[model samples]
Target: MKSVIFSFLLILALPLSMNGNDFKGIKRITANESQNESNSWINFVKLFELSEIPEKSLTQIACDSKYWLWINEKLVVFEGQLKRGPTPNDTYYDEVDIASYLKLGKNKIAILVWYFGKDGFSHKSSGQAGLVFKNDVLHINSDNTWLSRLNKAFEYTSRDYPNYRLSESNVRFDARKESFDWILLEDNLRGFGRAKVLGDAESSPWNKLVKRPIPLWKNSGLKEYKNKINFPFVSKGDTLILTLPYNAQITPYFKIRSDAGKVIDIRTDNYRIGNTLSVRAEYVTSSGLQEYESLGWMNGHQVRYYFPEGVEIMDVKYRETGYDTEFTGSFTCNDAFFNRLWDKALRTLYVTMRDTYMDCPDRERAQWWGDLVNESGEAFYALSPSAASLTQKGMLELINWQRSDGTIYSPVPGMYTSELPGQMLASIGYYGFWNYYMNTGDKETVEKVYNGVKKYLSVWETDEKGILVHREGDWYWGDWGTNIDKQGIFNAFYYLALKGFKNMSELLGYNGEVKKTQEKMDAFKKAFNAQLWKNGEYRSETYTGETDDRTQALAVVAGLADEAKFPEILQKLKTQKFASPYLEKYVLEALFIMGYEEYGLQRMKERYSEMINDPARTTLYELWNIGSGSVNHAWSGGGLTILSQYVCGVYPVEAAWKTIRIRPQMGSLTYAATENTTVNGKFSVEINKSNGKYRIHTLLPQESNAIVMIPVSYKKINLNNHLIWNGKEKRNQWSEYLGIDNGYHTFKIKSGNWNFVAE
Candidate 1:
């Protein structure tokens, strides 16, 4: 009782700053007096005297759109804050630990806030240029005490502007109008004034506050290019071209000596990706030598700088940055095509992650939830556990944007609130929310969005025969290719959403809800067969086009079609090539799920041969043919998940991988090895067949269990050296030999390093 009392007292004594909303009396402050428009930049500086540095000093910062921080004139945060609106009216704040950058005595802090004044598909306009900050330990709060100014040097570029899908605009910086040394000290404070306090933290516009769920970006500080363009090269009226090794999200930097007002236009080859305007910048020279790194990021393989004939380039480089994660997952096999395909898919997945799981970084950097479903699944198999937070953020955002009438929309945090019925169904279905919970074991997140999921699913209804009343909500988009078969595909997706909700209900111990959900699923399945399944394929009466591989694939994956239909569907998939790359993943997965491992691999190779064989391609395209489409699409990287989950066969049998299954389906390959980081720990497996013997090695994390299955072709089985199976009976020791299922010998194993050989 005494200890409990002491713990309660300790909690009461803890600093209020522990919470992101604990801004005390801190106010939203702004510097813009002139009419603030789109693409506005404001610089702020604050000086404080600290007798001695504290052990730890964390700061809470809230801004309208985005910010960059500097402590003692050293770059601390490259970009901070998630795009606002956890809900329609809420805002997000960032908590950054500034202890390492702090020092004793007089210290200076600088911030550059870029307010995206216009609303786009990904950001909501706050209608005011404001910032709120608090650091109780450091005795700092954003108020009238801070000095700020509207930067006149930063202006909208006269060049092409980005389309409405994007929130960012092309920036043009006039070096003569501003002083770069203002960050160092108050060397030039001509236009500076005290910051105007707007109101408290709970003011209008930004009514609610939430902590940022994902980590700040990982900044790869200025790196020189490997493709040498020989520094100090003088230009002669032509554009200077420097190519990065591959497609990347980067900020271009260059230092050059040129005459005043000579404009140097900088952009990437993909400034107009998918034939749509993307982000780029321009640098107007001051007088003599000047250095500038454009804050706006561009994506492409090559960087081009158009100069006016007389500029002498001293050095050129760029900084690469992306979502904070490490490539802990890996896949390799004897086949080079599959290896290269997996590599390209993994690269594409990483670039598509930033503010949200983007459809494509070069095009609209919007969170199309259909794209997010595939991206989240791929993250579990390709990246470390840190990537899971991004998935959580996306799930929350998708649900938070739910409308009152039980409808949901995507490409959110901004203006595009139109519902894409098929995509919305996929977003809340088994592959999106349930897959995330299975891999992450985040029941809290599940609980947070469960009501929203139930609400969205409630909007969907069925006719008298129990077939879903096809909803063409705002957009009836099914896939990017021909022969959509919308009616059949929507039925399959609705069933999938019902199935996922039932599982979630079961996990949450909602017994009544589970039973209710299961009844709906069963009815839907029976009605779907009666209405859509005919002539060995599940094509609806409404669909008159060719049999859609995507619809057939979804029916198989969702278990809506019977086992009798598998052979016919297999034949159709073998001959048809109508599904886009987005739906192709499900087709490949369904083939694997049906035990057509060889055919699954063959289809993968055939479908992705062009992307794999291209010498210049480092990422997958939005479509299979790759004509006038985005080069880096997250939905197209579903192969990354297929390669790791099916080819390597390492998947969670239970939530958070408390139980895992190692069922290697290395079709024709003699050797295959793969590893991926899970919530439990790192799980790896290597399999090879040589000299009439199959060797299997696995590393399972502690406190977990594994179910290992080896092909029945190898009659004699040995574990570590002891003969566990002698072609007839089994001798059990550390492993319990479960009865064979589906032409393989099964064993239940505890977590540890295990090696098995079957000869």
Candidate 2:
């Protein structure tokens, strides 16, 4: 089986731009007297006066006191909690999109924010309210208010609402004494009432709200420039320049025809500080335009440009943009330590796998093992490094806690009650260790861990049914605390284990053991195929005889399908009409492996879109449903991996180490870019595209044979001194063979020559 080498850095530089409109500013408000609050409340009411009534989308109204987001006085979101902080339970927050709720003009928005008590576990402490646009643009208002009377009422009643508790009946008569204190922060935008504690002097009710300036696009006076300009040709010693709209901040990008319309340059400098109208240029041709000579200028709203002599222009565009406030979080010594420590851990795992197994012990064995393992591990670790580390530590603790009989129980108390499948667990560890070794090529560590892994596997053998008997049943435990029959994933792992055993036996010069292991592997594969595959598709179980479970999808993704039947099986799976929230990820993986990239990307986009829109989701979750807490599962991390593999098309080919084939299926994407992607060890790749051309920049990790495949119409491959193969019969089988080396290597490719490296 061919292993794909992925590096941690490879994913960081993905060019999927986040919509910049989501961030909005917050203003603080103070509460003094009810009448003063009423004046402040008028300003909040202005929001509705400016728009038509009955907003269609939901608006979130979060406040310390009794607050309601009113659509023409009809409360859409009401949170009457006299508490301090955000609700610990995930359900308290409301995210409503009110696009349909608003008319052309004059809409009323009102809020009554009050301070209850010291910021506690309620929604009051960090009081915040906002409106979200269809584009995810957010406008945040005041966060917290402190009113003494409200606190008394809240104390009298142990419920979020001061007036009533839905679960409990008796209303405190003193709750009426909780006169609402409104401290209004006045600003041109909006103002809501606020409250103060008894010990502190009642702050004056005044408007302190600061309205954010409307975006430049909303200004009708601004000239709209959306035309596409292209340069016919780019020759040596030639420079090309184009004029663009100049603002305080300008985003300039160009499409170069040389790489099949790939984006050659993007200027994001000075974007965050403020908008600036400026012209910047990079040399398109060395002879005509010097690097410094290709420059432009931003003169107010008009952009002027000058290109060094001889350079031809392809296409130019610009946009007005802004930046979000920088986030500040804690940093610790452990952060730096862990950065190095994880790499070291990866190296250790690699060395252990190499010395124990792998095809080549002395020549490139550890390197291969380390490369594969580190890449896979890095993919998951990059998403949530903390979680990855915890998982590693947990697995290690489990390993150490194994009993003398080789039975390993869960380390987390009450998490599991049964012993682990001794053989299965050993196989998983070995596989992980092997991947680490393939990524780093650490032989010593591989040798150290080899005996233990081998001994563990050797304890089990094939039974009359040809299954690896005595192995633990269902090691994953159904991922939801239930253990059914031995699962397909576990069975696949068993096959991999047998394969690992055979490799180890040969690597250690144990020829007799090797023969036996190979025989066992063959028998296992045959029995597994016979039992699990029926009607031309893989099945999830032998007992129920069902083939529609998600596990079967995983099997396909893991490359367990027979090559001849792969296409048909994949088509069937796609047309099965099975749509479950839990099975989307598995289906996506299977589709991606089957080369259904377009479908896979659509599925991924739908999932992420749902995640972004779901009010229940503040951050990405493990599953789509509410009341589910597997929010940190490694399986969810697979989305990023799929993005890298399918969308970006940065695949690993063992024969070619230097070059990666680019097969982008991102539909309707006018432009795209990715950053900081690491391939082989030190190599990094940056890809940018606009129109149809792709500009690919690669950094080599070590000296190795590299092959890049570009689309058939592009002939720049020859210009770049790269090989061009136009085999009609095997147009999709282009490949590169990188020689041996392990440092950072770099190269460039264009879309037109993509077919040269397809396979």
Candidate 3:
């Protein structure tokens, strides 16, 4: 029996090597129900008994749809990512140590597994479906021995726009349609048939279930509710609205005791203005104890619910999502708006952050590559050190999903990534590679996936201009604007990719690859200037003679322009019109690059100021005006990343924080302090301006070198009044230049705290 699970795993699998462990002894199981799988939606209930519990009893399992296990009716991990299945392989298994949840006597185990069993946008199945449960002393694999009955209440349905990417199902739950509590040891299964077996053969790869060599992806669950507002008519009338304090990831639950055969229409938000998940429920039992259960989860700042007219009155209870992690970093100062924005920015990331960095809790819970890049920009320093694991997992997951044509899907592990463009692949190679390597100094990851990523990048390389042109089967999403030529943005990202390979070359001792990549990158930049630079700013469209924010922003930040053109570039860059929070990240980086510290901070405040008050936003928003996209988009929190790395002046110049860099851009900010954690260790910095004296205090990571930069427009500078750094009369692009260009002073110091007062 153990050999049954280990035979094929003993051979080899492409993704299994990366997980660092081997397959556990477990047999894949399924009901022998008829070949028409989707026609009969069924839950396989397996009843297994253990004579005695072992001291180290551990249970792990993986199923196609979703499964809830009851060890004496004690639920595990509350119900997880089983429903939105990610191409079930060896990596998606969930393992839990059930030593404490078990008793010595005859313990019972029952699992209700839901299989969508159909092709859709979310779960594009590999076809073979089953469940495998493994433990040292006992086993309960899905087989014909398991009790199976068709579940009639759930009928999978699709939706339109706002709820489009949602893999939703309409639940017309008839409790009378439900079988008795077969989950309990005492419930009778009068006419249940045994589940037909599935995934049992060794020759077919899809028919096997292997142990998860790596731990399951991290789960940063829901947020703690501020205050729950029940609409005035939750129980009294048909229509109701529950206004949350701010945007949140929530699961809606309804506990009702209505008369039998009553129908109720429930919504997760207001239909006319905001996104809402529609849930339909029809009661079958007359009020003993019944639940409408949870719909396919919803997220919003304010949500509305409708109960419909002519339904009998019943009680209701609503529960919010639970907080999975406590954010550890802090950012605050004299300005209340920045403080509020910083706090909300952290929430924005955490709200959408879970096992994967979901783009939004709404619509697409899919992982967007660049969004993860910007997410780690703040998440690394803001959340606990443990949270870095998610970033690691995210990068690996993308790499693990590389396609045969050397193309990695842009929004990973999704069925619809069939057409995302080559430009969309930029972050996976550049931002993602650099962020992971620098933050954690994990080279094993680089060693394992760098070649696959390079292959992915190879799909876009061309010989004519050393830059990629959109070829067959590519999609372009260059922010939200009509006139901008997305190609310019694509070139900028291409520059970033070449640079990523160059960096990877230096790290891996591939000196030839480094020179080759650098040569191509240089040629690409030269071609960029000749083709796109028009009248100071980079022209957005190749022939339209138009320029927009993203084109210039991405080019400048990617360093496609020489330093001589920066001041000129910034002047034109800031003038171009629109900005979405996602694009604003690159825009912010470009602003700080040209030393517009004051201007950058002002832009951030102006854009997010309204979000700070009126309703006192809990997370930074998807759009500048609010109510546009998911309220907690990952890239929206770029403010905190800007504040921590640029304003407070703490960043890593090399892989890991081995050589720390600090160049504070305190344009109008009088004082600020920041505490952040990295793979190397914890570090912080503080700056205060009193009267005419500017005091700077910094705490560098214990074993790393610190590169500090001080802003001194007109100064005879001194470190503890001894003069460690002096301002030059020459003006560099990196200085604010209050009549002088060399207003900023740079320093390299050893680990430990240092203080300097400049005047």
Candidate 4:
């Protein structure tokens, strides 16, 4: 048993503002307008009016335009030679600083676009531009206003480079005779105007044109097209018919609702060119709304519909008919219980995880655990008041899938044909299980999973050092292809597993194993510290002299380092500037656990904000960087677990079965809340902290006592039936049950004013 050691550094620098909040105020402009010919150049100049041009400097401009920006006849930003569609390597928008280029009064911004084809074309249609300004912002609304122009830019172009021409092609045609030009003009003094020029002058050449027709095809027709159909009223067992008409091939989208306001069915009729398609209809007798889709013929006239087996008909509406057509139909949809958007997003994540799992045949079983680990955790966090049950069920599924030899395979079949370090999956799964149990206080689940998890840990222990050893191939391909050798993080996780085993064993009256595991833990800690720590910092390896790596940093943060060395470790973290974005997020978590609150909080804010700014601002990522993989990474999401536990100060110590210790450090955040956190049983906890006051609302299955840690210098404190003062007295309480289990208790603290801690 060797101690996993690492150094810590103090980060004192203020958080950097990557991009100001100014971008959030800017209006969204679309590139796909129905006014343009299908697969032809779209004139977008009529969509907006430039007025009251601010005199301030422009900080940044994000637009998907193959053109130039002219403020009062001065070229500010020029993205030359528009390529077709979005290139994989192109940065989505031109984030330019035109602060030195913008003018005060009336200014003119002109754009010239060519229609080569639709988004998929290598080079065809063109006429897309958006302007990001400094002071006054653009407002887009439902009404067809100049600023209200809508285009499905993200659908066709790369989200990174919004202006790249995604429709490029070489059809061996005369460029002068076949190509067309799309142009737009924005005059703060004169409003806006647009025109299109065809290579063939006889092909309806553009002149002085009035405001173009609103591109109702993409955004106008359906208010909530993706949602289950909303119906005003419906009768039971009625066959609802939804028809959408189009001059060419189109798909009719509709939602069905019952008379009782329940969604009954949804149908889509897919028709080819010159064909009228209709989808058949059926009705079921369910209490809630049901959704479905159908494919048939519709010649801009009659289209059939379909319903689920037990759903009754309520109402229906045509969502968009085709990708390239402007057919619109009207109907209502039933109110759905669940949010369709959220459900769809979750489904997308599931599909992505499944697909990624399929790609790695060698790590199927491990991948399964990995997927389950993330899915279950997300489910737990997502569904409020029901997270505990869902978490339990998900954990049991993993437990059931465990192999008899204590190892778990990747989720996919026939993956990881070789004996790799399957323990990584087991380690992560156990962590999730333990976390859920601690949060919900479910003894039964802990008892159920404990043996399997212990067995899994047991198989990995090497007799030579009495330490868990994972082979080389089993290591995760993380930061710079670094090979792990008895890695620090792995060792820390092993310590956690042993701690869990000890707790469960004690609870189950398995005294002998508990003592044995405790002895092993102590020995492991000693060896780990002696071998891994050197020169006031934790070395990356016992054999190598590399002093600072994320793994070593995390090990120290995870409490695997000797307590006596913590102060020195903390100093090292500060010196190393641990707040660098290049560092792994898990290392940040480690710092938080080591009491580097300011440093950790700053890093969290930066990382969280970065994630939010991304086009796919998701709670998870495959790695910190975008587009690293086809699927969002599960491990990155796992970092949230650490965030909730440490930064939010929601500690679920076993000593106090019913109490949750909260020590919030939200800098400058006016309001913060986390909900539906399952503790033990079917219990839940929701925490809200604002203006220096913290509140903990509990939804427990049974009455239990909880110990809570509140900030110092509070006017008053409250617990369910107890009140304790801070300082020496509270320190005594913490020491008494430092590593022991106590009954349920709820404690809360309120501070009168803000305070800062000095390192």
Candidate number of the best lDDT: 1
lDDT digits (tens) for residues 605-672 of candidate 3: 77777666746457765677666465567777888888888888777887667887777777788888
**Per-model TM-score versus the true fold:** 0.96, 0.42, 0.84, 0.46
Candidate numbers, best lDDT first, in rank order: 1, 3, 4, 2
TM-score, structure 1 vs. true: 0.96
Q: CA lDDT of 68 in candidate 4? A: 40
- Give the poorly placed runs of model 3, Cα more than 4 Å off: 1-25, 32-52, 81-91, 118-122, 139-145, 153-164, 201-234, 270-285, 302-325, 462-473, 609-617, 626-628, 700-702, 712-744, 749-756
Displacement of the residue 61 alpha carbon in candidate 1, Å: 0.6
Cα lDDT listed for each candidate: 0.85, 0.35, 0.62, 0.38
- Over 4 Å off, model 1: 1-19, 32-34, 186-188
Cα lDDT of model 4 by residue, 15-108, tens digit:
1111223333334333334344332222233333344544443233332224344444454533222222111112122233444544445333
Error of 1 at 428 (Å): 1.4
lDDT of 2 by residue, 333-368 (tens): 112322222222222222212111111111111112
Worst 10 residues of 2 by lDDT: 210-219
The runs of at least 3 residues in candidate 4 whose Cα sits more than 4 Å from the true structure, single-residue gaps closed, are 1-223, 226-382, 385-406, 412-430, 441-448, 463-470, 473-486, 540-549, 571-585, 615-619, 654-657, 667-671, 677-702, 712-759
Error (Å) of candidate 2 at residue 174 is 31
User: Residue 601 CA error for candidate 4 (Å)?
Assistant: 1.6
Error of 3 at 64 (Å): 1.0
